[model samples]
Target: MIRSLKEEIYKFIHQKNSLYGLVALVLLMIYSALTSKTNADSLISVFGAIEWIPIILIAIGSAFFAMEYSNNTILLLLYKNSERSKIYIAKFLTILLYGIVLATTSIITALLLSIVLKSRQYNLFTVIAGKTILIQLGLNILGMIIYSLFAVAMSFMLIMLIRVNAVVICIGLAWGFFGTSLSTALMKTLPTISNILKWNPLNMVFISQQLSKPHYYRVSQLSNLQLIMGTLFYSLLFAILGYLLFRRRRV
Candidate 1:
């Protein structure tokens, strides 16, 4: 399993689409630096911004996998006696591993730029800045991993069932950009939709808006226990669905 995963990840890393994920890391750091309020705060927030970095790479993953499916390579893999589940797991793990590496790269890059340029005036040692920065990193990274996984599942669904490249990219971007709006609309409807869509990670952004204290947002609203259970439920649900679909696919 380990060797298979390693080779899968290596192939993914060497792909042109995989290189696009690096652009995400750079953009994430840039966005973090610019949006952060204080010079000192920027340092902290740049690292924190790592949390959602996986999200930026989701498009790349979708396009990559979708291409494979569209080109019939995925079918070729299956013909070689590769189990669908193993292939899906390997591809999924590769994207996730890339996310982690991307986050680390962004964090280190931001820190290095801060040191070499001394231009941002973002002092590295401010306590509030430092603490909140880490907090943001945690939030962003966790959100990205979860959301990116969402994309991975979406990729499998569309690639196998719907083969249009432009359509897939359009849908992925639409969701990536406005997904929270769907969550909000569902949450706002009159009929007890809370239980239905609370399981949706898209709701996390909307709930985040209601936060009086950013750090405590998840803890206060859902309680740590509820959040954990809900997250686990969603993750398991999507993972199972993706696996079943892949297994049952005729290609």
Candidate 2:
């Protein structure tokens, strides 16, 4: 399991798409910081970049498995002595690790830039230590991590089922970008049946919003606990489904 995991990490690190994704993330972070006219805090930049995480993870997750299938490399891995479950688990871990690294780097980059360039007049350490900033930053980081896992699980399920990169990317992006609006519209349009769609993974991704806004229930029609539980439940549900299908899938 360790060997398989290591190989998965190594492959992810060497992948050109992964490298390109990092570059794009960095560019987006810088752009966001530059555009923040009033509030150019490290936390702001970090959160801004994180808004793109779902799209990034979707691209990474889809490509990670699809590449193997496209190159016929999955066949070679299957012939190795590793169990199918281990292979899928290794891939899932790779996605999780990448997401963590991406979020960590975004925070670090934002902090450095904030202190050195963005906030030259104020002491960044003091600002970061402030109660509100600290809490908000912590919540933002936590939300991004959870949502990243959500992206990984959902993308894994989609990619495994269709084995199509384009379709997975489209569905992932659509959900990431417009999911909240769609949910709201559904709730407004079908007030009677809206409860059924409220537990969807798309609605659960509003965790960041719920965390930042104390009055989130008024806006999202969901309590913080609901969002948290929904996120965890759907993430696990999709992951298990993906694993079950993957184990029996013919490479």
Candidate 3:
């Protein structure tokens, strides 16, 4: 498993398009900071900005697995007697690692930019200390990582089932944004079932915000522990389904 993971990591790092996403994420963070009126404002902006990270994770996940099928690389691995389960697990771990790096980069970029472009009218020390900005930063980053993993599993499942990169991406984007919102809205109409919506992967989008700012517009129905557990369950469920489909796939 370790060797497979190393191999998967090597493949991911060597992909030319991988760096582009990271660069874009950093630029977005910087821009968000630049337009902010205060350090705390920038912090909030950065946190909101990272909300789109699940889409990024989906794109990467789709492309990563799609390439293997499209290039017939999976056949080559099987020819070499590689265990399918190990390959799937390695890819999962690799995507999780990628999410960690992306989240960390976002947090670091946001913090540095906030410090550099801080508003002169605002007392930086007071805002930072009062809000416990460092702790919030950690929570935000962790939340993004969790969301990214869930997205990775979802995209991987779609990719394995569809075996088409473009379709996978389209479905991922549509569901990540529109489908989730629609579900949330519909759930609200049924007050009794609304509470169960919190367990949906899409609704967990505000997990980090709920942790750092309970008063945020989109409050979570689940407690922090419940949210975390729900996310893990969704991720695990998608991963298991993805692997099962991959095993039975013609490729």
Candidate 4:
């Protein structure tokens, strides 16, 4: 199982498109580092601008799964003596690995940018040292991981229902965005809706960057157990949904 999983992961990393995307991301990092303004507003603008990574990640995650199945390579794997269970878990881990890679890229970009663009207003290094940055970075990475894996779940889920994975890929982004935007808004009239929003995987990803900073938003005096419990519930749902879909899938 480990060997099979490792082989698939290796294949995922070596794919021509994946390699190119990594290269593009690296180049962007360099560009960001060099082009960063030596001012405060520009520094804030840089971190704020990184939301694009999640959008790209969602598209990539969908394509990653769809490409395997649509191209018939995944079906071939089933014939290679590997169990569906192993493959399912492998795919899950691969998406998580992909998210980590991208999240690392984002962090590296930010760290380099912070060093180059460090200022009185954007003093990330001085304001936050090793422990602080580690905490903040953990939140950022954790948030991205959740969303990216959710993308993987989405990609697998949609590919089973639709023939073309690209359609799902396109719709996944829209769904993700819409899901995130409506989560909090819907909670108002529908008390249940509010409870449901807590499990929204994208919330931590979108708000992690801001929430790490104390002064930015008011630290609520009230506890939010619903949100915490909802996250756990939704995560379980994502796993079960993927298992059910792939277990019965033609692949």
RMSD of each: 4.1, 2.6, 2.6, 4.4
The TM-score between candidate 2 and the true structure equals: 0.90
Model 3: worst 10 consecutive residues (lDDT sum):
121-130
Residue-level lDDT tens digits of model 1 in 186-206: 666734757665657665432
Instruction: At residue 30, give the lDDT of candidate 2.
Output: 78
Better of 1 and 3 by TM-score: 3
Task: Flag clash pairs in model 4.
Answer: none
lDDT of 4 at 96: 66
Task: Give a tens-digit lDDT track for model 3, residues 78-165.
Answer: 7765578999999988987888888777767766766676545543334453476556656666777787888899988999888888
| lDDT ranking from best candidate downward | 2, 3, 1, 4
Q: Cα deviation in Å at residue 7, candidate 3? A: 1.0
Which regions of candidate 3 deviate over 4 angstroms? 35-38, 44-49, 120-131, 216-218
Error of 2 at 233 (Å): 0.6
In order, the Cα lDDT scores of the candidates are 0.58, 0.78, 0.74, 0.58
Weakest 10 consecutive residues of candidate 1 by summed lDDT: 204-213
lDDT of candidate 4? 0.58
Instruction: Report the number of the highest-TM-score candidate.
Output: 2
Q: Choose 3 or 4, whichever is better by lDDT.
A: 3
Distance from true position, residue 204, model 3, in Å?
1.9
